[model samples]
Target: MAVNKVKKVFGCSECGTEFPRWQGQCSGCKAWNSISELRVSSSPQVTRNDKLSGFSGMLESKIRKLSEIEIEELPRLDSSFDELNRVLGGGFVAGSAVLIGGNPGAGKSTLLLQVACNLSLNETILYVTGEESLQQVAMRADRLNLPKKKLNILSETSINKICDISNQLRPKLIIIDSIQVMYLDDLTSSPGSISQVRESASALTQYAKKNNVIIIMVGHVTKDGSIAGPKVLEHCIDASIMLDISDDSRFRILRSHKNRFGAINELGIFAMTEKGMKEVRNPSAIFLTNKNNNTEGSVISVLWEGTRSLLIELQALVDTSASSIPKRISVGLDQNRLNLMIAILHKHGNIQIYDQDVYVNVVGGVKVSETSIDLCLILALVSSLKNKSLPENLVVFGEVGLGGEIRPVSYGQERVREAFKHGFDIAMMPKANLQKNKPDGLKIIYVDKIEDALSKLIDIIS
Candidate 1:
């Protein structure tokens, strides 16, 4: 056994900031008692091997001109799931590192296993887990009814050891069930510390690019819905994807925040079932319910998520408030935006809601943050306060400005087609978004101002 030199260090628990010495408050985040003393290994550092990946094996280094350089697009390894592929910007690009962060029991492992199995039909994949045993992963695979292939699974945590195995196998793709628990053998800090998480991810990323292997690493999110590790982990990754699940466990939304090759804010819909995650082909049907289409306080809204348009229902309930200042409550929608929309309704639509307790929700627990849903949100609030139901098939989507102007949104044609496919007859949208060729089944009701849309809705409801 080697003697590991240990030194006293101070680290912030809240933001994972390291301090040279102990202090009452963390200077980085300004939190009390957030700093704690830690014993970290100081010496016997894990140095990089230049010859490991031919970085030092090449002779005569010479700078080449941009035109002389050969550019080759890396091949994509399809996971066979279009939802995953689309979110990943087509597929897992060779020699790229993709990081996935999610809450516990959010189907991170299940989705990775499913992907590995799907790709194993033609390529090599290694699924490594530091938190679970081989038997546990095997049981999960069995429960998901995953078809057995050449997919390999390993129960390990040592970063060096896992890298050695990866190099030996030269797998086309590798997955670290989690990067948080993985630690370098020479790092003094324990696994999950700020240093360990950051260093381990850096090493893994370098290995992926050097070996031409795709690395998919799992990460856990903090309380504020951010990756728990150091902020640099996200910066170092080729793509940063998050999987969010609602309380009811009906569907999971996969969102890509950072992608080197694909578009950002790309969304993928999945339904959690006994057989693992199933892709939601049509999100409109899942988010909108026509059963209570005629009910008061329910307004149909079309939201553009990624390249798809989702038809969702905004339900608002209004009642007398006991307090002078009414409480503004919202779910799956920004409270601040809701408040702004309510203020606009009172100012422009002559709908006074200052003393009423307003509660708004997006159906199916789906979150709608796009400005295009602002018009529908205000419509739902006004309809609830007046106790009237708008048209059954009326679909509203457009941004509402403080001056009562209806702003146009992108992908207007796609939103209209999505609404028409769902049997929606009339669409109340911004006048500027009206296309020359409209779908046969849908009637576009263009409104330039909030008052115009409100007048149209109030006429039908009254």
Candidate 2:
């Protein structure tokens, strides 16, 4: 009698590379102990005699005419957080899979739990946790002061078990605490391995689509602030949001990077409290500092957070330094952008502070990526260099070009209106941005060049 020998294949957990045999180091990611036995597949795994049938049968495909199709609004479940609603583009769409990634202690779990409790009022919610026990979740619920509601809690990591229970219950919404710790038992890799994460996500996506259940999955982030596991995980989900906190800031920003159903790059603001994550109603107000005081190196810029307009203060400090090479330190604003603006000021505005150490920070740690704040940044640098304090009730926003020309930005009128609502009396913007329909009760000051801006706002006219 002849005996059959089993052959095993190994896979890299770090980079999802597969190997026919085990290796000490992963050839893909070069990480030690990251490679592990994946599975044992017999050479004659599937015999011709064995018929592949059953399953859910085959799926039918169809196509429809654009004019014949009826348009209807997608149903969304309210998460009870307006800020979250904004970032999610109205609310959590039914049957949509949302993968939220964040660092540990960044409130990814807390935010999801909070939303789960809120949704349990009208919808049945299943909260699954692979990393924590039932008792641990209960303790957190108590700490959060959550009501004893119809929300179901399950502490299992097996993807098969999760799917079975989720399908049976058919809950309106399902919240998975963290997807990294989930795995399919059939796979030989660890829970956090790349294969496990990918398979688990695929299962969740299928479950949501087939059952019409909204699934919210929490994902751990890498040290670089990117979602853990394969980059494909983000693409697999209907929407992906990230929770990020800046160093020495109490505020956390919920930013949506991928959304198939709605807008992308939408933002939500939240503040961490002892109770739980509290959504900030007026996020722009939180970014303002010492509004009454007129300080040098401090200037306000209008920022567009999605469709909403926000007034953010940019603070800069410029002083003579002993070092031959002047230092440029920028936080929450692009360093390259600041450098270009500084060079623009030198060549165009004839305002030179190249030999001085400069530091620019976006107040309250709110990251501003739009080029609309360029003129405001240059103004802050000019104020710092000239030791001039801008008027306390002034708001400035415009795109500054390399030729020292100020350009128009989108939604300029809305920016001015938001600034005025926040008690900003004076609005300084590009002349091109001042359209026919302007807001009332706001002092409008238009300028075309960097020199014009400086001469109009500050005493440094030379």
Candidate 3:
């Protein structure tokens, strides 16, 4: 009989790429000093890997033609929260493993508890909390006035025991309070280690698929906002959603980073209250408030978020630089893109602000990522530079190219309709976005070049 030997290898914590030896840098993710040691067996014998192959006994992999495969629509489990469902692209798919990550005190537990309570009424749900004790969870549920009769709660850190109980209970969903604290007894390393976290998540995901159960795992994020643990943890899960909240705000933004079952980059809004997390159904209304008293730099723009259209307020401030080098700061927007937009303003719009400091902000703490906000941002910059306040009823959105041409963005018609519905009187956009069947009462200004837009702004402001 041949003896089984152990092989020590190095792995990148950022990307989970394995290496034969330790190195200062990870070649996979190009991260500095992220390589860590990992040990595995080099045995020829069939082990747990064979069990997780998702095959039955005496059966081998078979090749099937794509035309022969049957396509069936699977019924999704509704969490009863419209905001969450919207972000999830409908509902949670059966047998899918979802990872929700957030900073500490971002209402991750509160949100999940509320969801589990609402979902427990219809189906069997298991909430396994490894970080908190049963009493703590119970106290929170009671304080939040949530239904607790049907929800099964388990305080376990051992993944094996959790799986054993789950197998017997045969729940429709399993909620792991956190994956970092979960550990396998077979592994000698401590819990929260890279190996433990990766293995534990993999095992839970495999179990979810094999048993047709939904597993929702809560993950902690590092200071840089990336999920804690090997990046492979994200790759193995079906969906990775993030709950974001600022220190001074009570609002929480739930967005998807990865989703195999639905659309990605979907945004959901919620407000944390004394009772629990309440869904913000009309997020656009909440974000568009108090615009009547608009300032010199304030501008309203429409953002295409996931499947819906959102009206956002953009504010920019330009002032003389106090330091030798002017500061270009942006909040709730991309900093690098702010610099590029400033350069475009100088070259195309003929508004030079190289020596002045520029600051831009998106109201309501919503991050604007779409390029459609480019025209709106440029207009806001010009408005601030000239100390001119744009009309509160005017909405602007279009992409500005380096050559000073205003480009059309996606879903222009929908954006225009959303602006019109919000009582905006004027819409400044690219000529390409002009609709044959325009909104009835609103005025649409089609500007093809940056100079034309500046002139229009002057006309509207004057």
RMSD in Å for all candidates: 2.8, 4.3, 2.5
Residue 211 Cα positional deviation in candidate 3, in Å, after optimal superposition: 1.1
How far is 208's C-alpha from truth in model 3 (Å)?
1.2
Ranked candidates, highest lDDT first: 3, 1, 2
**Each model's backbone clash number:** 1, 0, 0
Tens-place lDDT per residue, model 2, 1-462, is 543445567776566788988889977878887676655435453222111111112245467688997888889888899999899999988878999988888888888888888778778889998888888878888999987477888988887788778767879999887899987755555787676788778777777776678989999987767888875688679999999885535778899999887788888889898888998888788877445486898988899877688888899999997899999999999999999998998998887888999999887767788999998998888888888788888888999988889999999988988898889888889999865866677789999998898788764333
Highest lDDT: which candidate? 3
Q: Could you estimate the TM-score for every candidate?
A: 0.92, 0.88, 0.94
Q: Write the per-residue lDDT of candidate 3 for residues 208-323, one digit (tens) a residue.
A: 88888899999999889999999999999999999998433878989999998888889999988999998988878888765657589999999998888999999999999999
Candidate 2, superposed: residue stretches over 4 Å from native: 1-58, 61-71, 246-249, 289-292, 459-462
User: Please, what is the whole-model Cα lDDT of each candidate in the order they appear?
Assistant: 0.85, 0.82, 0.88
Instruction: Kindly give the stretch of ten consecutive residues in candidate 1 with the minimal lDDT sum.
Output: 50-59
* Deviation (Å) of 265 in candidate 3: 0.9
Best-matching candidate per TM-score:
3
In terms of lDDT, the poorest run of 10 residues in model 2 is: 48-57
